[model samples]
Structures are given as C-alpha cells and as structure tokens.
Target: MSQSKITPKSYKVLAVDDNEDITELLEYTLSKEGYQVKTTWDGSTAIQLAQSFLPDLILLDISMPIMDGIEAGRLLRQIPALDYTFLIYLTARVEEYAEVAAFDIGADDYLIKPIKPRALVSRLKALLRDKNELAYSSTEFRIGDLKIDSLSYTINYQNKVLQLPKKEFELLYFLVQHQDTVYTREQLLSHVWGAGMHITPRTIDVHIRKIRERTGFDYIKTVKGIGYKFTTEPENT
Candidate 1:
C-alpha cells in the first residue's frame, strides 16, 4: 500500500534569518502556499521555537548573529524529537566548503540566496513529498536483538537505545527492510534520498560509515566491489 500525500496545510515550517525582510518573505510565501509558518531572527531562537513548534521543516539562514546555522543545526540534530525534521539551508554563502559544512551538519537541502519565494516553496513541497514517501509503517520490528521502532524512529540494541541523524536512520531502515539485497550507491541515493535530490554517491559512503559506527557492522555489510546490504548472517569481521 502507498502512503497518502500530505497536504500543505498539514505541514509546518520555521524560517530563521537575521534579515527581517527575508523572513517576512518566507512567511508570506509559505503561508500563501498553505503551510503553517513561524519566523525567528536568530539561530538560538529558532532552536527554542523548534522544540515547541516541532516543525516538519526548517528554512535556516547560515549567517546570523549570536549563533550561526551550522552550530544550530548540529545542536538540533542532537534533539531526538527533531531527528526527522527536514533542515534546509538558505544562505548567501556560495563557497564549496560552506555547502559541505551544511551537509556535514545534516542539512536536507541548501538554497543559495536571492530569496526566490516560489522556487523555495517548490523545493519544500518536493522535499516533504519525498519525506512522506520515506515514512515507514508504524509497526516496530526486530532483527535479532536490534529493535527498530518506525513510529518513534528509535533503534534499540542490547537494551540500549541508539539514535542516528535523519538520513542515517532512513538509510539503515531501508537496508534492514530489504535484507540481503545489495544496492549500489546510486541506487541507494535514489531510493533513500529520493529522485532529483542533489545528493552525491559519496554521501552514501559517509552515511554508511556513520551507521556502522553507531550500530556496529553486524547488519549492514559492504560488498567489496559493489555497494552494501543488510544481512542476518554474522559479518566476518
């Protein structure tokens, strides 16, 4: 069975930018598109608001006083409640490293600023659509002693709870669901990141490494010349 499409009104967005004008534009644009919107001027305030608002997506500006988006994103990623929240960077920084830093902190997407409201809304809709598709069934399942609860996005191993960032969780969940089916990096990107998303194949490797670090190498195994897969058999590590 396919998941139902999420309506715009059912979506909530938080826009954070030091520029009042840009925030106002974001509010106006997204609101008109039927999303519930909140605006904040600084990263700290955005974090506070996110805890209460629990927004489905965040439009964050990379440059802001008191706290920058990168720091805010890192902290936000640590919040288990916001683990699945989509974070997109709205910044003027066009440097390659800046984009790398954003992705390193778990950014879902990045938009270089000129504040094109319509295009931004399009991106948000696409992202939310992809998220809805990735949403797992509410049921929880176990592979040996490892427990993955789709409802709360929690992983329990050996009676201890483990939390991974959003992307990592999705990647691991996908592999576990399709145990023993080896997937190439490009295939994993399309399946997990969704089609047309600007994620590269290398991003898959990075996420795979992190997943191993957090959950150990028992489940997901790399196929030397191919890609990776989840297996019930013990890895020969």
Candidate 2:
C-alpha cells in the first residue's frame, strides 16, 4: 500500500492597517503565497480579533483611528498567550527615532512605506522561516541564574518568570548560546534581525539596554570602538 502525501501547515498572518487598499493588497498577495491572511481596519478591532485568531505573524501600521499600533503592541505584549506572535511594523515614518521607538516596543521588523510587493512577501517568508526554525531548534537554555525556555518563550530570572518579546528573547538566546563571544553591531544585526533588513546598528543598542534593564544584569558587555558581547562572567559580580 502506498502512503499518502502530507502537506505542510500554512502560516497565519494578521494585517492591521487603516488603509483599505493596503489591506487588500496584502490579503491578495499573501493569499497567493499560501498564507492564511486576515485584515482589520483599526488597531482596537485587530487586538480583539488577535486574541481569538492567534495568528503566527502580525503586519501592523503605526497610525490609525481608535488606537494606534504602538498601543496595540503594548497591550499585546501583556498577554502571555500572544508572546510568540511576530510583529512587523509597516509605516511611512522614516525618522530614526520612530524606528527606535518601534523596536523598543517589541517590533521584530520595521518596513517603511512604498515597499515593493515582492520584497514584502520575501521579508514575510523570511520572518516565518526564522520563527519556525527557532521553534523547532531547542526548548531549554541555562546560563548562570538566567533560565531560558524557548518552548514557552519565558525566561526564569532569579526565581521570577519574565516574558521577553520575540526579538529580545532571540537576541538573548543567541548571545547566551555563544557566551563570551563578542559580536559586532553589524554582525549581531545580521544574525538576529536577518540580513537585508533596513535597520540601524543603534537598534541593537536599544534592545541590549532593554534586556539589561529587565534582567538587572550587565552580562552584555560593550567593547569600545567595537560592538557587544555576552559574558558569562558579568561585571560587578
């Protein structure tokens, strides 16, 4: 008897943008790529739908009525159930400060407006691929007093459970995986954020700062005139 062929699961993508045209384009384009796509016109409605839909990825816009994407992202981060969902901000804001703020708020990638359809699709595919790879790679990691469980996307820090955004967790995990290895800002960006992504190296600094603040440990060391390193031997220890 011949075995039946098995098909891979399609990724679920939720797009929240006020522009009908953009949403329609995303739906049509993503649908063609075999993704389960859903669209909402506002952040408030998007949040409500997200709880039920539980999408694997979210394409969010920063400006909208009712609620903006930043507020929505803040609220979503508070929900433990949605911790693993990848968020990409699609906005027209090209300011460096705005990009920094978006990254600070847990955005995995920020794509400025006037993006090419094919490029957007390629980026989405890359993000989903990376996410899937991380999910299936490993589940548990222990470094000093910091315990990281990729399966639950939670970190046990000094007996307290802390939830880090996807990018932050990935960054920490990568650094911890290669303890004492100093990675330049550019190298870290390529490794963590993926290559071809239009993000400044300073973005890495912001994420590192956040991780330091949350963990209350200066394990990530900065080498002057270079980049950063994750040292098992933390300073002031």
On the 0 to 100 scale, the lDDT of residue 148 in model 1 is 86
Estimate TM-scores for all models. 0.80, 0.90
lDDT of 2 by residue, 13-82 (tens): 8999999999999998888878888999888998899999998888999999999988888787777678
Q: How many clashing pairs per prediction, in order?
A: 0, 0
List of clashing residue pairs for candidate 1? none
- Which residue runs does candidate 1 get wrong by more than 4 Å? 1-6, 92-97, 111-119, 130-136
Identify the candidate with maximal TM-score: 2
User: TM-score of predicted model 2?
Assistant: 0.90
Residue 170, candidate 1: Cα error in Å is: 1.0
Residue 42's lDDT in candidate 1: 92
Candidate 1 vs. true structure, TM-score? 0.80
**Model 2 residue 189 lDDT?**
92
Q: In model 1, what is the error at residue 42, expressed in angstroms?
A: 2.7
The regions of model 2 sitting more than 4 angstroms off are 1-9
